[model samples]
Target: MSLENNKAFASVLTAGIILLASGFAATMLYHPQDLEENAFKIEVADSGAEVDAAAPAGPVIEPISALLASADIAAGEKGFKKCSACHSIESGGANKIGPALWGVVDRTRASVDGFSYSDVLNGMNSETWDYEALNEFLAKPKAYAPGTKMGFAGLKKVDQRADLIAYLRQQSDSPAALPE
Candidate 1:
């Protein structure tokens, strides 16, 4: 072949090779793996104990009142760091990602002016931020009020939640009475 034809042939060959390699790589990457026959097998309990698959996991949380009795406001202030990203506890504090929490304790739900609240919160317009309500909400925001806009993963430790709630109570002009 002439020099120009040879160059053209080489270029076509290189293009064809690249195309074939890309196709091979794509097939390898996109191919689904076959699941093993035992992939979904339920393991038999060796101890002869019955397992209830439908039962809820985790320990039942105690009432917030019991926890609040010994809640440490200082520790709660520290725990408030997690909330500071979204909330401002200072009186008359400007709303950030969340509504300012200056008087959140005992305050009506979704009552902040100018801040847009989620429909879930708005639906609870008659509800107050009482201790039990706050605890339940904090324990599992999604569970307490499904479709809540609060992104908190929920405080797992009861004491930490109490502390956080205490700190919030202190932020108010007139803090709500602690649970008996």
Candidate 2:
């Protein structure tokens, strides 16, 4: 055979060998399981059917006062700086990007007049806002209300949320105390 033809054939054979070795090595090294075949299976017994799985245990939440004290007013105030861009806490202040937040604490959700609210907030048939509910909502907006249009991402730190709620409480007055 001509030298050129021999060299070309040798190169092609070498390439084929490399490809075959690579594919075999990969399959041997990583024997991936077929999820559709075996991963999803149902077991039946004479008594009944049973399924087994594992999930992480959820965390135990603490009280609002303890969380707030841990966060401190200063931290909450700092956190509020971001909110100041769209909201105002001064009593009777005009609504800006968002509504005036002067007396939001303990007030009914979406009860503010004139300002429009999402259906989710308006649909909530709740009496009044409380510390625990406020904390959950602040921690994660969408998670808490599902369809709220507040636009705020959410505060991760529980203490920070408590502090913010505390700050709101300070700005607003409690509902008129009922007389016996």
TM-score of each model, in listed order: 0.72, 0.59
Q: In candidate 1, what are the lDDT values of residues 8-60, reduced to their tens digit? A: 99999999999999999999889787876766776332452786889775457
- Best model number under TM-score: 1
For candidate 1, give the lDDT: 0.86
The CA lDDT of each predicted structure is 0.86, 0.72
Any residue pairs clashing in model 1, and if so which?
A: none
Q: Which ten residues in a row have the lowest lDDT in candidate 2?
A: 43-52
**Where in model 2 is the C-alpha error above 4 Å?**
1-63, 69-71, 174-180
Write candidate 2's Cα lDDT for 1-180 as tens digits.
899999999999999999999999999899776666666565322242543447432344455756554546666777889899988888888777777887776678777777787787788747566777777778767666666667787887777787888777667656322112
Report the Cα lDDT for candidate 2: 0.72
Error of 1 at 22 (Å): 6.3
